[model samples]
Target: MRRFNLKEFRSERNLTQKQLIAKTGIPNVTITQIENGHKSLSKELRKRIFDAFQVDERLYVA
Candidate 1:
């Protein structure tokens, strides 16, 4: 699976995966997998991620 540059975004936002998990209520493992491109997101998870990062959905899904 192709990875989204989630780590870059997080760095830009000065957030760690642990911080993101805390903010989004996503598990750390799930965040790790998403960052590593080992997992695809469900709609709900995607929404949470978007909310956490304040990013447009198109940026992620495209």
Candidate 2:
């Protein structure tokens, strides 16, 4: 899968980290780490993010 473009996605949606947390139920630090590439997207986190964005995972994976 390609890297999750958290920063770009958030920017496009005008969503702050806190707002994303509220929307996705992901912890703030984890979101920060993911955005900074310090962490990888686990299956569960990807699912949560996809659900929040209402996106299909096939669009992310080859």
Candidate 3:
């Protein structure tokens, strides 16, 4: 199974966690937790991510 690497994607955009938080209005802790696998990606958050990155949601899930 292929897995999406959040770190890589984020890095490719040159967006720091703080920058992502600013762009998406998602809290830093929540973003950190989700990136670290400490929390699941909520539907809202996933949508925000898609909006922020213009990437398909399926890439995030798989």
lDDT of 1 by residue, 1-62 (tens): 23446677778789978888888999989878977889877788877878876777775534
- Which candidate wins on lDDT? 2
Residue 7 in candidate 3 has what lDDT?
63
> Residues 1-31, candidate 3, lDDT per residue (tens digit)?
2366656667989989888888888988888
Q: TM-score winner among the candidates?
A: 2
lDDT, residue 55, model 1: 70
Cα lDDT of candidate 2 equals: 0.85
For each predicted model, how many residue pairs clash, with residues at least 3 apart or on different chains? 0, 0, 0
1 or 3, greater by lDDT: 3
* lDDT over C-alpha atoms for residue 29 of model 1: 90
In the predicted model 3, the residue pairs found to clash are none
lDDT of 1: 0.77
Q: After superposition, how far is residue 38 of candidate 2 from its true place, in Å?
A: 1.0
Off by over 4 Å in 3: 58-62
